[model samples]
Target: MPQARLLPAYLVQRYHGWKATTYQDNKSWYRRLAASGQHPRAMVISCCDSRVHVTSIFGADEGEFFIHRNVANLVPPYTPDGQTHGTSAAVEYAVTSLGVAHIVVLGHSNCGGVKGCLDMCSGEAPELLETSSFVGRWMDILRPGYERVKDVDAAFRARALEKQSVLVSIDNLMTFPFVAKAVEEESLTLHGLWTDVGEGGLEQFDPVRGEFLPV
Candidate 1:
């Protein structure tokens, strides 16, 4: 195994600063959480993009949300093949163990993953179609979403596909038996959200209108 390097000085300094302030002020709360364990009310599946701050967006505190970040924030259709599936594992734990009441699939504008998917679908990015490309394989989850927006005007297709990624994830979530059972019993709900990273605009998917409305 390769030797692990020490953390950078800036990160170490920041950690010490946080420990002296935020950790000191919330010591008791942290201890209580450690003892009582987490009981988050929602599970947020959001993009791996640093700009998409799920906690900051909702002003959520520690232990309040079970977050799972992935490339493009995707949830694949249920494939119980006993393979290593990180996203599916997180969902299973959140629904069956944590009993989260809501699952939010968050997407955003100006997303590189969405752009990559659009390029791959349009034959502009052939490298992503390689069998050895992990990103390309993972992005297969959004191919259906791409098909839905392929006919959209080129100027709006990227944005449209970004929202469709959220919708696709929501649809895929229902394929999980436990998730479907919880929703059927009214114990859980699903939501899709799209944000404009540059404009700080937020919109939510409305099933009734089949479109995203400003939130």
Candidate 2:
């Protein structure tokens, strides 16, 4: 048998230590969780930024949230083209299979993906202009947001786009028939969140006011 190319030695050691301590303190909890399947109450679609920790922000425990991470936390409109859609797949599973009550699209400040979109739209990053650029294509989901905020000052456009991305995703989530049906029946609720990493501030979207309020 061939050995797998594992993570760095220090990270592996840290994982071992964490595994031992977690199991030692929560052995029964882990055992019970293994016996019973996970029943998370919410599904969180969050940015794939290292600084953003969804679980830490909400003080969520294991099996509490079904999390899906993607660039800029953007959700493209639901298209049933039979092509691969990782984010859509996760959303479908969370709604249909897990029956989660809440779905949150979490966007954060200083998202590299958002910045990339900004750069691409502004013609600063020509490399992203290529049709073969995955980041460019994926970030295209946020292009509509950029158009809305294009007139804003360059310094603030990025931040504006970050919040816009959340709004865009929330709209896209509704494009899915199952999601719309669930929402219409009051079986599922959608939420949008924007976080400031440096200032440790959290803002929640208010559908009534059409704005994000501090949390």
Candidate 3:
């Protein structure tokens, strides 16, 4: 909870240079954002992978989308155990508090967590399931998914796992009472998307086709 005191002042210089062109034109926006409240259109749950950026891909400006990032964007079934999760809290607030109309789960190609779960590739068992180390447990949630495509060609298998992980996250996203209620009441729509990191291809979930289709 400490202030971002570690932020290098020089890094502000990078933004400073751009501020003249963009920051100057949007000075009112900065003022209003500071004074006004957040009114985002959607909530995006994405991976912690550095290569996969939600804001950049969607060209979302600050406050346009409420976002939550985790090692694999895993949404646990609503647990009343008093352990509040940032992702779950974001969903609760965005839906119940802010009334966002859509919730998007974004996953990408060549995810290390998916790969670990797909192949159970971790070297140590304790390390796999540890509270802080999530790949093992999160991967377990997708074990059925892994088995669902394990026998396919290696290239196809990888693609399937990455794609299936989005579905897994979507299903889990629904387990939260707020999310389910919102969806049931038609207040919110859920979307699962796969981004091909290499070429930035956008694929949307096609339930009828039982796969992702180019969009």
Expressed as tens digits, the lDDT of each residue in 1-215 for candidate 2 is: 47878799999999899889987899899889889999999999999999999999999988999999999998999999999999999999999999999999999999999999999999999999899999999999999999999999988999999999999999999999999999999999999999999999999998789888998
Q: List pairs with backbone clashes in candidate 1.
A: none
lDDT of 1 by residue, 119-152 (tens): 9999999999999989999999999999999999
**Reference-based TM-score, model 2:** 0.96
Best by lDDT: 1
Give RMSD to native, each candidate.
0.7, 1.4, 2.9
Candidates in order, TM-scores: namely: 0.98, 0.96, 0.86
Off by over 4 Å in 3: 1-12, 121-132
TM-score winner, 1 or 3? 1
The numbered model that scores best in TM-score is 1
User: Quick one: ranking by lDDT, best first?
Assistant: 1, 2, 3
- Alpha-carbon runs more than 4 Å astray in model 2: 1-4
Clashes of 1: 0
lDDT of each: 0.95, 0.95, 0.81
